[model samples]
Target: MNKIEIIARRILGWKLNRWDRWYDFEKEQFIPVSEFQPEENIEHAMLIVERLKELGFSYKTNGTSGACFGDVCETGETLAQAITNAAYSVADNSSIDEGWL
Candidate 1:
């Protein structure tokens, strides 16, 4: 893994600022809500999911050809809860609490 990934593994996870608040594991950095999905492609979604997985997050969602809706966790909570927390943090521009990771 890379430095950021290493950082990510060390209780230093990130939550993207994007709509989904997708965390970047490789960089252990947040992307911000603006970078989410203007196009909303599966490739991008999967990319985000991959990063989340590195953070030990998991998800499973059905698709109608190419979309999904599922969970992201290992944090002992629902993905929605995680996202809400993320959104709140983003709204507040607060520092990341890797401790929660």
Candidate 2:
């Protein structure tokens, strides 16, 4: 697996169920609550969410779920692929050294 795939699976708790979605511990369910949403940009948003959590920031979906259709990329990659790419980008751009961990 690529670096992004590792991060998404190990850090973000993404599950592969036809596509990819984050597991919500509070709700004991997945967000977006849909088997498919052609326009959702969940992949990238999930990464951002995890980063915020790491920074001691908190958030709630507030009963709202789903991403904007406009956020979807034209590359035709699945949600999982998108998330993997996002993770790789983050890891590549991060200033923090992995050796610290």
TM-score of each: 0.32, 0.29
lDDT to native, each model:
0.38, 0.43
Clash pairs for candidate 2: none
For residues 1-101, write the lDDT of model 1, one tens digit per residue.
33223322333345434444547565666654445431333443454445445655544533232222133222213443333333223223236455544
Best by the TM-score measure: 1
> How many clashes (backbone N, Cα, C below 3 Å) per candidate?
4, 0
**Candidate 2 steric clashes:** 0
After best superposition, candidate 2 residue 59: deviation in angstroms? 16
Question: Per-residue lDDT for 68 in model 2?
Answer: 21
Weakest 10 consecutive residues, lDDT, candidate 2? 67-76
RMSD of 2: 9.5
Best by lDDT: 2
Write the residue-wise lDDT of candidate 2 on 13-100 in tens digits.
5554334554645347674424322224564556555653574434343223321222222122454444334344444445645442
